[model samples]
Target chain A: MELEALSVGQYSFIQNAYSFGFAVMAAATLFFWLMKSEIAPAYRLAITITGLVTAVAAYHYLQIMLSWGAAVDVTSGEVISTGKPFNQAYRYVDWLLTVPLLLIELILVMRLSRQETIKRTTVLGGAAALMIVLGYPGEVSSAGGLRFVFWVLSMIPFVYIVYQLVVGLKESISQQPESVKNLINISVYLVIGSWLFYPIVYLFPLVGLEGGAAITAVEVGYTVADIVAKAVFGVFIFMIAMRKSQEIEGTASTVSKPAAAAENETSKPS
Target chain B: MELEALSVGQYSFIQNAYSFGFAVMAAATLFFWLMKSEIAPAYRLAITITGLVTAVAAYHYLQIMLSWGAAVDVTSGEVISTGKPFNQAYRYVDWLLTVPLLLIELILVMRLSRQETIKRTTVLGGAAALMIVLGYPGEVSSAGGLRFVFWVLSMIPFVYIVYQLVVGLKESISQQPESVKNLINISVYLVIGSWLFYPIVYLFPLVGLEGGAAITAVEVGYTVADIVAKAVFGVFIFMIAMRKSQEIEGTASTVSKPAAAAENETSKPS
Candidate 1:
């Protein structure tokens, strides 16, 4: 199965998949931004960042879909020979914008200290962006070895990201309210698990999938991963934020009582 | 464009879209079932039913995808004439099982009286299932007039469902805690809004869309609607359940003071 043998129908399918993903992401963005909630400021920022991540991805996916559609003859479902090539770079562009924000938002929702948040966000966010940038050459490369080389280069940052999330954040996560500790752990695992799909999709060509099947697998695979990473993960983020907000409120109500008692005694007969 | 002019690529796209939707639904089902939460039993049942809805839809969608994939000659991206006809019936089958569960779940989460639950679930669920059954004949009919007639028949039940959800549930929803009241309203609206898409998709052919375009529109449209109806709506259900659970706890602590005081009096030195 050579690249030239890829049908226009496959491209249409890919384009439509992207289009669907974009629509969902855009809707989620609106939801996270517009929905009423009494969550804390830190978590509110997390929600806003979640929306931004999806919005950016939605914009890029729209571009990717357009590029794919432009390359196909819609009526016949055939790839036009003379049309502009499908812009695969749009994915990398999306990742560059979203990957860092993904880490930053997660850190924000944790409501860690300013120093800790800054440290983790800088290290993890930078690594995430670097991972995407490193993966780009491989994504666009036709040569198998070049793709593999860039993939390996990209994995370094990915591994670092996993470490920062899993190991570096361990103590802080452990100190979170018991209700949301498990949720935070699950969110971390969700991020790590969904992300692993990208590398597998990247390596599909090496596994003997070529042309239409490979393209279909890659496109479908990425779309699935994108939904999980953006929409589903956003749901988890919102849940965590809600739980943490409740916890803060509960603590404030309990802790304010002693202070109120002391103020009553001081003011009563002085 | 005639239905026969529907291209292999279009079918491939539709099949893949269904597959993606199935994967997400299955994952969501598991999340609802397995995730740790402190929601009440009524709400927990709601969560379980949410899972069941998606799980059934996912299974049927898998069958639909397989039927579509079997019809396609993957290598050439062409639909084979002799292959098993794409199982449009699977959608109806799925709706029969899940649509009723969807209504029942919403009623259960509202924690209505047993009689009210039964009454609402029976009327709403029965209407929902009937709506799907009525629409199926229209979906399969070649004659435009027959399809239109069946579609009109289906809308009767749809209007009934809207009435029950919006009007019948009004008092019960109003009695819910303030935190969850808006959510219940939104959930009802979400259900009605997402459902309206199905009728629109059914009537697309009547509006001059035909062949590949109509098929594409219908499949993609239904896929989007399904995601919203099941997955996105489930998220709202979970949120409402969480808030209600918190409210229940809050009220229990505050309202139990009299009983505690009475017990203290009974146990005193007298």
Candidate 2:
């Protein structure tokens, strides 16, 4: 891309956008690095890396935006006429970065759940992965057919996630602590809400939105919500994992208390 | 907020945005409600009320978008400009709903911390409150001055929050659970990162972003990060809260266990 040749203003836009992207990537990377020793750090790492890569792509695009702003539009390759090449390049990078992250997160969730013997984790994780993969064609396609395919793929994960949540709730209803239940319920809503965003972004514009504005608005909105749901929600899930680990430790101590006390008494004089 | 006459497309764009907004609001409300007995139920009620209001306002904006799209752009304001006005109106409502919620969450944390006799909670909570109040001006003002004010104000909570976490680490240096420490650290980064976003968004555009596109991009990125931080981080807080409460209960049970056993032995016949 002609990033090196941009005007001062374009350079600033790119710099700012890139800086923002860098912050995201750096934070994600650092967070994962810190979490590496935990039970399921790979998923966290993948997610963070995705976030990091996305930030890098975003920064590049911001650079493009700065340069292209004076000449034409950011997406349609409008303003500078020369801007299309760079814009498309960045857009492709953005997609490539995000899609894999989504897949990795799903796989990680699946593996973790399987370890915990949660059957639904695999199904839901697979569905989420499938949805992401299927949606790609629609995402990259010009003709709405790719979108339709993507929507169907995406819906599977949404449904699976909701299903896993429902099952989790039912299982928890018997003996789960209120906090655990709350975590599960809230996490479900977050994931579901995120999944629902795709269709809303893709299909909602059919009514009255003209040209690229609707798409732009949808993209912007979804990106914001997605980031929030993934990162923030990911944190919550980690907390839950930790909480569960703690509970197991607590139970172990409780169960061993009597035996430990008897052994202590035996060592003392009668 | 001329929202009565919407074309299908404009209506859809506005509707989808509002839908996502409503989902977030609803999830937050549900979470607050679930934890009402622990925190203040009143706050949850307030959030619910605010969310409902946002939903209504969203509906109104959808109509406005529809009308704007359907009508020709009359520069003289001859034909009602539904687009910008409604969009601004929606943004205003969003600000009203969220800013208050942020403050409320901080207050709730302070109140709970006080009840638990955690000194840092009160101080940190107070700082957060002050920041939220300061952010109001920043939220409203489009000027660099206002933005700077809000930026500084917002930073205060982050600083306080970090202080609180660091102190927690210091207090429990030897005994602090790895999970708790990791969670706290993640939160510190997430919150601080979000706090830094406003300046970047405002300042970056001055260099090159002539149109609203770059500003919008920054806003979108900020919103995504912020939402993730708040809601997702909020979940971690919830998990921690639940864990803490459970720990409290466990301690209570352990403390009373021997006494109860002794009482039972004394009452039994020889």
Candidate 3:
């Protein structure tokens, strides 16, 4: 991708966003890891995957910050190109690894049947990967038409994942304990809504925003979406897990030890 | 770590070992990956772990080669430093990841019971990690006595692993099918023997050898031990897995798949 020059204000905004994104992701990772033992064994892997997602995002955000520093020149009192490329691919790479993982953590938190879990994750996770792969060509393309082509192509899988989350997982979500059902439902919608934010940002240049404005909007937009999708969603996962564990514990206490394992269907998600 | 300067001949020798080590490890990684499905599902995890060990080794060897290139100045003809430190920690880092994996792969090939598998892997893999970690401080220490102290500390774990492989696994080895019993036993010995070679190499500087010869001996020694320990042992693991699969197939045909799972056990190693 061609590099973009920015005004000092635009440059400062992106730099701050990158720094804040890293801090949020890093914080989420630490939060998940530290809170892991509070959840039931069955839900811990969901938290672990959540941790992994945030950790991967934190690493990429750090990389993006470093790349931005190397590729931008501010010593002249204005933002100028440093003749080195800012690796926009870092965001795509982060999304590629974490998006599928995002779907997986949600699937895990639902405690679906083994075959159902495998089937949904295989289809949905594979779709998430395909969506990202299809989107990348357009992401790096200079031509607006080519970018739009990939946008449409990627949307096929994007829509599939959204549908799978909203409709296909309805049964599983309903079966979750009363305390966590709404939590999961809200988290699912949060994923779909945050993900929708991604493509709109992808269209910044195509929407006639140019140069610094377009780049700034895209960078800041993606940063905001990432925090909402990963960190905020992670907090929701933590909440759902806490609620589910309490459900399991409450049932265990009322019905005695025999019912302890009735709710924790799966030991670990794939 | 203090950097070591080398003679031209020593530099060339160490360089060749680094290059050849990379090729060996990469080739083993490819071989194990390609042959994964050929093994019984029960033993394929062993193959996968083997692949991981070699893959990690390949990556570190590549890093070592790059570090070597950047640290050495060949323009002087006689060996000279570029003032950039050659990172010797790559070897320890590689061991930290792959050594535990090496132990786990062997346990998987044996197909021990779930409890047995978990217990052995926890104890042995943990010991392997401790061995590597303890050795690192000594490897980097300038004082021979301090190095020797760490060596002794690391040996505590090393001997435990060797004993676990030989004496502790005696019953597991005996229960193996006719075809793979000796194969497992031989691989066990191979591990114990190859591991011994590492400490010998670690002691090179403490011995009479000094300067270029000591660095060359240690480098070449560690590289050879790595190939034998990882690549060669991986091949042994592959052979054992192949034999176990064949045993499963042979019994599967006669007993009509009521025994398809007879020899194979534990779907995946941790």
Candidate 4:
């Protein structure tokens, strides 16, 4: 009971660690909202991802309350069984918060890049689906098996995404502004960084590891990293979302200039 | 024993119902693989969504296996608690199948319409997030409460999407092909139809629903609707994705025409 009680001590660290992600998400949402009137086409995907991720982060913050406060009944096993509102609440929040963000990120990349290939999008979508399945409730039951399945499943999307990032970076350099490129690269790297914890989480549980401290450390560390990647860095992605309108306006105006000039020539007193 | 046998029979029906979803999902994946090399950019989002929704339908099928399969042995009063593996597996598959599709649909709309409004995209993404959350395992645990929540959550995204469709139709009347518009309208209607089932599912249990007949009807009906919406209708949406490359190519070729014409005029026997 004492050890279980001590688990509550981690909340402050979590709150502090997660704050950065929250701030980023909130800032990004606001950024998009404020600039709603001026945003352009190319930037639309990025901004949408930013806003959705932020909302997810916000909901995730609430998930901690459900897990620790609501779901944790001392009478039950220290290990929570996802039976009722509490477990469902926790997993539901987790799914809702993260899935769309992943989807948004992939879509943003595909839409922004010059390669708008259907095959590429299909492959990416399939990979992402594998990752999602690996994370679902049924997978959570068989920790070892689920971990193995998901580790393999998640790889399909994760590797494909990295490939996309590289290709997208190359395509973006020619078309997008420097700011957009930098933000996108950082965001992709951050997302990849967050995923690194999956293998650690998967493997640590499998080794019959019972060091309470070590498990806590890994769990907390992963949570913090995810918060930063998806939320804090997510804000920077949002900032780019905010800047989308300017980028589109700039491109459209550039494209429209020739048409405008042609009109001028036709109207001239020749 | 008779009552127990009856319950067992009920559970079996539930399990098989979800199989339909999975079968369609596999079909969807195969469909995309077959068409991977041929589709155009305009149809990318639509095709990806169609493929993913089919996958989601398949995932639901798998989930029925997990949920109903486990229901057989648990004592009547006890909560049918399958371990974490079961829960996570089903939810993960659901997320993998649905989120990217929703995200891609929004991106497709943004690019296809050329409207480029940040507000619209963010709104769409937010709606997608809400739908994803509602579709999560925990969200549907209490068939009664969950069904209501699901209906509301699903509606938000659908309504916002319809708005996007209206705006897109008006904005791109000149540039977009009539075939693309027809596909878009049909896809929207189909998805909306699937969403309508949430209320029916919710209402059935409230109206004292029981037995293989009622449950089978609801489960199978929902599954069929989703297949048509996400897979069959979705295939038509893929056709829409095929139209985009030509438009972009047209822009590239025509935009340079005046420049080429001017250069020819200037070099003419001067």
Q: Against the unseen true structure, what C-alpha lDDT does each candidate score?
A: 0.73, 0.44, 0.79, 0.51
Give the true-contact fraction for every prediction, in order: 0.00, 0.00, 0.00, 0.00
The worst-scoring run of ten residues by lDDT in candidate 1 chain A lies at A261-270
What's the CA error at residue B77 for candidate 2, in Å?
48
Error of model 4, residue A51, in angstroms: 0.4
Please give the ranking of all candidate structures by lDDT, highest first, separated by commas.
Answer: 3, 1, 4, 2
Candidate 3 Cα misplacement greater than 4 A, ranges = A1-4, A258-270, B1-106, B113-270
CA error at residue B26 for candidate 3, angstroms: 19
Question: Per-residue lDDT for A137-183 in model 3, tens only?
Answer: 78767799999999999999998888888888776676667778788
lDDT of each residue in A1-270, candidate 2, tens digit only: 233333333332333333333333333333433343332343444445434544454455455445444433322112233433434334435544453454344334323444543444445445555656665666556566556766676676666556755664365333544435566556556766765666676565334453344434553455455454555455445544444433443345644333222222222222
lDDT (Cα, 0-100) at B122 in candidate 4: 61
Task: Give the C-alpha interface root-mean-square deviation per candidate.
Answer: 16.5, 18.0, 14.9, 14.4
Looking at model 3, residue A19 earns an lDDT score of 100
Top-down TM-score ranking: 3, 1, 4, 2
**Among these predicted structures, which one has the highest lDDT?**
3
Residues A180-255 of candidate 4 have per-residue lDDT tens digits of 6677666667766776765566566566653545545654675666566665665665566555444444444666
| lDDT (10s digit) by residue, model 4, range B1-270 | 112323333443334335435544554554554354345455555565666666666656666555655544434323343433333235435644464465456356435435553445566666666655655543446566666666677666656665765574456433546535665666656665665665456467556665556756665676666566566665555555644443444355655433323222222222
Q: In model 1, which runs have C-alpha deviations exceeding 4 angstroms?
A: A1-4, A7-9, A77-82, A254-270, B1-270
- Predicted structure with the largest TM-score when compared to the true one: 3
